[model samples]
Target: MKISNAHLRSFRNHNETAFEFGTRVNVLLGENGQGKTNALEALSFLCLTKSFYASADATVMQQHGTFFEIKSVLLSDKGKEFHVRVTYDDEKKTKKFTINGADVEKFSSVIGMFPVVILSPENSSITFGSPADRRKFVDLVISQSSKSYVENAMEYRRIVRQRNMILSEAKGKDCSSEIAPWNEMLITYGSRIIGKRNQFLSEFAPYIAQTYLDIVDERETPKIEYAPSISIKPDSSLEEIAAAMEQKLAKKKNDELRFQTTLVGPHRDEIIFSLNGMSLKHFASQGQHKTFLVALKVAEFFFLKERCNETPIFLLDDVFSELDEYRSRKLLSLAESLGQIFITTTSEKIFGGAEWNNERRKFFIKSGEVAQEPVTA
Candidate 1:
């Protein structure tokens, strides 16, 4: 998919900004804190129905403004166009998303409609951070690709929260009678989530491996292992997963009361990344970490492209700043060959010897505005 154009109003530092994007590579060039990332965030909001980084919609609104709006024209791979608009009213604490003038009541439904893959500096945590970070990364990728996954995840979270509340109120006492219904619900939804995650990890293994081989010349074999909270094999059926969850819940009943939290669910899962059998977190260098993270994202792009109806748009936020010239150019070449991509960088020197045309244009951003004419060279 390609974003043909976008308009931003009262978003971050952008009081009013408009963009006419290219079909291939559109670069946003500017110095730090000049709203380059904000523009890219707007595009993400347009596609995902929420901000990529910000936890609250109000955080992205202008300081003195009570609302924010983003409108865009998106083109699908199958020669279809989508007019998407996202608006927020801080006064009423309401956020609305519309596609082609029709209001989308459920934001989850709009997820894979315009598939997207995002790689930002914050994504470094996927490799170097805690297991929760890794789970978040995988969850987002899976959520976009599968429609039922999001709802299952949402219901699972609700069940966990309710169960935790019951445990907290029990104060280390046995509350089996009160929590019985929630326990069954937890096992039901939790098993579905674990089964889906297991299936996704199994399917995604090959994509990451091939992408790593395609991008890196080294003979490195990357592997992702799904360590669910419950004990089960990857090929375990839903009944087996549910039975395992029930057994674990029984074992952790006293511990859950002591901790006052749901302890036996996918929420405590871990995803380990390894390079040639060595743990990425414990053994990989900084370069290997970056490369592995990039490969995962590229793999996500292709995976979503095949799973979703539309080709996913790629967003690279200030990634080239950390890479060497060779890898930067290599990534640029590879990204351009993919579908439409938007890259944000502090310098235009990365494109020094690269080809540019109407399909690959550069926009200079300064003070939340497109500063000058798009550079096409």
Candidate 2:
């Protein structure tokens, strides 16, 4: 999908800003804290119905501003147009997502509509941070590719929260009677999540491997293994996964009572990334970590492009700052080869000797507003 234009109001440092994007590569160039990243975040909000970095809607709202709104014109691959608008009211604490002037009651329904793949400095956590970070990375990719996975994940989270509440209130007492129904629900939803994760990881392994091969010159084999809380094979069926979850919950019941939480589920699962048989988190250097993370995101772009009906848009937030010159140029070429891409950076030197035409454009951002005269390389 391609974003033709976007208007942001009261979002972060952008009091009121408008964007006329290029059909291919659009660069947001400015020094740090000049609202370069904020513009990219607004694009993410328009596509995903929320901020990629900020957790709370109020956090992204401008200081003392009561509301924030982002509206965009998106074009699908088949020449279809989408008018997407996302608005949040502080007083009412309501967030609304509308497409083509039609209210989207369920925001989750918009997951794969305009597929997006974001790679920012924060994404380094996927390779260097804790397992929860990796799981989040995996979940977002699958959530965008499969709407059913998104629904199952949301329901599973609610189930776990409710189940944990019962366990917490019991205060180490036996609450089996009260938690039994939740257990059934948990197993039901949790198994589907795990099953989907299994299928996704298996299908995604090749994408990552091919991406690594395409991006890197070395003969390194990147592997992504699913470490579920329950014991099950890679090809385990939903019934088999459900059975395993039941067995695990039975064994962890005592521990759950002591900890006052739901112990056995996908929430506790781990996704291990390894390079040539070595764990990425334990052995990879900073450069390797960045490379792996980039590979993962590039792979995600291809995966989503193939899985979703729309071609995914790639968002790179200050990503060039983290890589060497050679890698940066390589990534730039790769990103340009992809569909539509939005890049935020402080330096325009990377675009040196690069052509800027109708398909590629640059915008100078200063304090949340685009400069009247854009500086071209």
Candidate 3:
């Protein structure tokens, strides 16, 4: 799968611009603040129907532009074509995402349709940040790889919010009976979430270990363990896990009223990463943290590919500067085995030893405009 072409209109600083690409290494070469990262942001919105950096959709539109629109023509290796369009109205703050002119009722339905993985400076949180960051990465990967997971996760979140509201309303009142319905929904969805997360870690751990060794030259990976609110066997059936979660939440009802929040579910779960039985987030050096994050991302790509049977379009957004020459080369080496790649670099010197195939295309982006000529090395 590949994006054959894309047109960006009124997005960020790009008033109007379009580019065509093939299935190979394509470099968006330019200096800082040249809209190179902005282009990648557009592509991200096209794939995910949301912005990773922006808090809202319309914020990505240009100040003077009335709307932000991006349209891309996706081509599959099977000789089929998909038209993906994402348009946001600045005035009304509405977003429309469609494939082949058909309206997309839910964004998750189309997330994995054009799967993409991004390596950027912003991903540092996945390694050195809080548990929420790590859980987000895990949820995103699982959501794309499994549509049922997405539905379950979404329903779980909805149930959490409803449960929280009920707890708040019952803080000093006698509404215990009303909250039971929410708990029933929560247990149904939360158990599935916990079970899926536990199962995912078991399946994905080997890839993380191998990728960590291949990239960081480490003998052991940071030990990954899924810490759920309710304990269950790795092979526990969904019904069995739900029963356990239901009983646990029943015990926590008094505590929930005391805290005025829902406390017993996957939302409260944590993924602990340790090395040599030491907490990696607290004990690992900065370099070690970065290597673990990179390894996780690489493992993410392989996991999605193996599960989905399609190589996702890989995006490396100004991450070379974050890595030394050796790791940059290592990342490039692994990426070459895949399909389309969009790498943005502020310095051309980084490509001195880089290899590009016959299908390679390099161009310069300046002030939201794409130049046909490649920037000089």
Candidate 4:
């Protein structure tokens, strides 16, 4: 899928702006604190229905405006056009999504319609960041690719929340009877999530390892392993898992009351990143970690392509300027081969005129205005 045009009104620094995008590479050049990244974020919000940097819609609205709107025309692989509009209001504290002029009741149905993957400079530190960051990284990518995984993950989180509430209310008594129903729901949804995650990683591991090997030119292999809170027994079906959870609930009744939170489930799952039997987070150099992050993202792009049968859109936020010449070239080369890519940079020098081609387009962002221009080599 590719975005043909994007219109931003009362968004960030932009009062009103509309610009057409190239089907291949489109670069947004500007200085720091300019609206280069904001334009990219606007496009991302249309596809993902959320902001990457801001937690609240108020953060994305113009300084003096109370509302923000983003409109885009997306062309699918089959030449079908999808018009998407997303509006946010602080007073109402709501986000509205419309596709083809019809309000979409469920956001999941709109996802994967115009799928995209983003890599920003912050992603470079993800491997070395907290476990929650890593889990979020994996979950966001996997969730976008599979709606079932998304639904199951959502249901699992809901069950976890409800069970925790019940634990909080059960003062000194055993909540075993009350927790049984939720435990069953958790296992049903949690197992599906775990199973899908495992399947994705099984297919994702080889691609990631190979890409890392190619980038590092090393003989050692990289490995990604799922570290779940509870060991899914070989003979234990979902029914059996639920039963085990129920038994564990009885055993840990007192502890649950003391902690006032649900424990022993997928909520505490993790992903282990290691290379040559050494944990990457602890042992890998800064450069190695960055390369690992890139490989993981590329593997995600390919995985989506293979699964969805459509080349997913790519968004790079000032990442080229953070990399060395060699790594930057490699990333741009890989991106050029993919579908539509929107890259933000503080300087045009990052492109270096080497990646410039007819299919690539360049735009200048100043304050809130976007000026369309072609790269001159």
Which predicted model would earn the best lDDT? 1
List, in order, the clash count of every candidate structure: 0, 0, 0, 0
lDDT of 2: 0.91
The number of the candidate with the highest TM-score is 1
What does the lDDT read for residue 234 in candidate 1? 86
| Candidate 2: residue 29 lDDT (0-100) | 92
Q: Model 2, stretches more than 4 Å misplaced?
A: 375-377
CA lDDT, every prediction? 0.93, 0.91, 0.83, 0.80
Local accuracy of candidate 4 as per-residue lDDT tens digits, 1-377: 88988999999998998877777889888888879889989998988788877888789999978899999999888889999999988789888999999998887766666778888877755688876677777787787788777777777888989989998888756777888788778767876666666666677888887777766766767888877666664344666555665566567667778898876666776778988889999999887788888888888888877777677899999887768887788888888788899998876765775455456778888888875555544
Q: What's the TM-score of every candidate structure?
A: 0.98, 0.98, 0.93, 0.91
In model 3, the runs with Cα more than 4 Å from the true position are 353-358, 372-377
RMSD in Å for all candidates = 1.1, 1.4, 2.2, 2.5
Residue 353 in model 4: shift from native, Å? Answer: 2.7
* Cα distance off (Å), candidate 3, residue 320: 1.1
lDDT of 2 at 76: 96
Tens-digit lDDT track of model 3 for 178-287:
98788788888888888889899999899888888887664754678888888887788999889989889878877888888988988888888877788888899887
Sum up the clashes in candidate 1. 0
lDDT of 2 by residue, 177-291 (tens): 9999999999999999999999999999999999999998988899999999998899999999999999999999999999999989999999999999999889988888888
Per-residue lDDT over 2-100 for candidate 1, one digit per residue giving the tens place of the 0 to 100 score: 899999999999999999898899999999999999999999998888898999999999998999999999988877888999999999999999899
Query: Which residue runs does candidate 4 get wrong by more than 4 Å?
Result: 233-251, 354-358, 371-377
How many angstroms is residue 70 displaced in model 3 relative to the true structure, after the best TM-score fit? Answer: 0.8
